[model samples]
Target: MRASASWAIRAVIAVTTVSVVAACGSGNDDGTSASPADGQKLSVVATTPEVADFVRNVGGDGVQVTQLIKPNVDPHEYEPTPADIQAIGTASVVVKNGVGMEKWLDQTIDAAGFDGTVVDTSQGVTLRKGDPDDEEMAEGDPHIWHNPLNAKIMAENIEKAFVAADSGRADTYRKNYRDYAAKLDALDAENTKKFDALPADQRKLVTNHDAFGYYIDRYRLEFVGSVIPSMDTSAELSASQLTDLVAKIKATGTKAIFSESSLPPKSAEAIAQQAGVKVVGGEDALYGDSLGTEGTPQGTYIGAEEHNTDTIVKALGG
Candidate 1:
């Protein structure tokens, strides 16, 4: 009887040990069932796909990112769905473009009462004001990524956010950010050199909207005018405004009328026809509202900037 009792005790100990080991390695040692690390991934959520790509570039291993906005969706008009709210609520870190770029985030998080670190990638960059023509812009223009310099700043901010969120992998985030920022710096230098070769007067740009303010401001190029009277493309331009913009383009001797890839090209085409100038579609149908489809040239931020630089330089005769 004593021998049998001892064997039973030993069997209980073995079961307990196995249970403990499984509990430690099975990813949910914590009481919270939906804890992020259970999947061995850093739970990250971003407002835009562009920001998601940036986070993936830096967060690397142990990170799973979800972009709130899909490709080709306008950030200006994105509304948070029930699924998006749940995603945001459960994320360990939420990265946003901020500067009013993700207009829905503020209210969504407020309503949900989320406590995760909200990283605004646009932090530290001086935001440009909206054009007088942009009626939808009640405040400043929030499209800072158009400038390579701002891209560098945003990459740094993402690095800091990732480090803060997961201190164990801080070094990985720092290295990735540094490497990407170096590439941005090189791109900036290349753009500056190429644009510098163009005559000051020839550096003027006309676009479908006022999305190019940051790009123009960074490069010291003149924003001659936009075809649309508002920053949000949902708004329509008046005939008087188009007539005035056409005259302004002619007056400035602008070389090209640049349109966005997502917007209807007819408006810009009409403007180009009225102004008697070339419509630079291929390169100038740029990534603004959303990036290109993955594996394409403008899919990534670096690729988009490169594509823009090549287009502008070619159009400007640099």
Candidate 2:
């Protein structure tokens, strides 16, 4: 089997069991959730913490969200455990960052016989195609959350899902969606303001992987290169590929590159060493795949974007 295949199998151990916290009470020892008090809140199952944050923002007290992946977990390499499968089976709705982001979702849902409403948050957002030669998806790119505008699109989808699950709360859900949309608009403007101040040449971004295409496109920045040229971090690079990347960096005079907190920075450090430049240092690395660990500034979507924008501005010498 290929290494990616093994990655899927190994990822099952990453999450031991479903954490079924009661909406009214506390967590259960077994992998079963307690019912909501008076059954007021909608039980929502979101795939990532980032999406779960969105649900909280929009759903408010009307929703009780259960996230499958923990903080700093990479969805690309994540495989659902039996507990996670059980959790989704009990949810009224499931929100996914769809455009091939969750390759394991279908199989897991099938095993659980889940018949809930699935909201693909990537709907109506323009997507960047993967490399024509990529084995997994030559026409799909799953990293949609990098662009704040795309978050607006996703937010709408999330709200729609919540409303659909509980039509009586449609008015409430729409109001919350509008409020959250304003926040995303503010974030987009904030980042664009900083990015627009930078010199066009300095907008070149090199990073651990070929992520951030949406953000780059939105800000009119350039994605110069990456140490790993694929969206999946589990993919490896040949020595020749790294050498070529180093040469590209030297030629482009790319000042600073970055890595993510979720993914290792070893390849980035190697490229920086060969190119004679420094990898970006910060309170947190970038938060492309997962948000920061819990209880930090970068733990939330907005906070992570703030950290990422600051890092990019400082690295690009804006």
Best by lDDT: 2
Cα displacement (angstroms), candidate 1, residue 217, comes to: 1.4
Residue-wise C-alpha lDDT for candidate 2, range 1-318, written one tens digit per residue: 247754764455334223322212222345333334465788888998788888888998789789888888877777677677677766767788887777777766654545567788988988898766566656578788888888888989998777766777789999999999999999999999998888888888888877788888889988878877788776778888888888888898889888887787887887788899888745548887888877887888999999999898988883
Q: Model 2 Cα RMSD, Å?
A: 5.2
TM-score for each of the candidates: 0.83, 0.88
Candidate 1 overall Cα lDDT vs. reference?
A: 0.74
Q: How many clashes in candidate 1?
A: 1
Clashes of each: 1, 0
Candidate that would win on TM-score: 2
In candidate 2, stretches whose alpha carbon ends up further than 4 angstroms from where it belongs are 1-39
Q: Candidate 2 — what's its lDDT?
A: 0.78
Residue 316's lDDT within candidate 1 is: 76
CA error at residue 248 for candidate 1, angstroms? 1.1
Predicted candidate 1 versus true structure: per-residue lDDT over 213-293, tens digit per residue: 788878889888887766677667788988998999888788898877767789899989989998877546777667887
